[model samples]
Target: MQFLLDSADRQRLSLDARPDGALTLVFDEATGEQASVAPRTLLWYKLACTLPAKLPPAIVRDYATKTFKPAQAYGALLNTLGPCR
Candidate 1:
């Protein structure tokens, strides 16, 4: 998953899969800093920016009320983010 932040500097952020199969957050900066985060950790932030706000109430309610194990939630988030290149 990739994002172009809407700030004055317009930073780029993406979730990339490393050659070792580990997931990493890649920052497109001069220093090329990268970090790995647990799926549960990512869930704490509102990571679903691609979702539409106009979704139906029932769908929204279902999403909000649903429970998931850490790994499951992470898989769901990955699905929402779509496939990484």
Candidate 2:
């Protein structure tokens, strides 16, 4: 349920942060093991960071909450320096 972590349903989109503090939403519906809609991928590359803020007005902007991949969810997963996933 953690950010960027594999999900059972795979519906839980996992987003992470980039080097410049931006975020990269990586959620490939197709595991390459089967077919799926938007199978090619539906990535949101380099989204702006929004940490210390709760519940982003836009659902796509929210940070890791309970189990959701927050916009700035890679704050810790990055060795405290890597991308915010």
Candidate of highest TM-score: 1
Model 2 regions lying over 4 Å from their true place: 1-10, 29-85
The C-alpha lDDT values of all candidates are 0.47, 0.39
Query: For residues 1-85, could you state the per-residue lDDT of candidate 2 as single tens digits?
Result: 1344334565555544344444444466365232221212332112222233334457545433676664444334333332334
Per-model TM-score versus the true fold: 0.36, 0.26
Q: CA shift at 19, candidate 2, in angstroms?
A: 3.1
RMSD of model 1, in Å?
11.1
**Candidate 1 residue-wise lDDT at 46:** 32
Residues 31-70 of candidate 1 have per-residue lDDT tens digits of: 7786764444553133434333244456445655346343
- Model 1 global lDDT (CA atoms, 0 to 1): 0.47
Best-performing candidate as measured by lDDT:
1
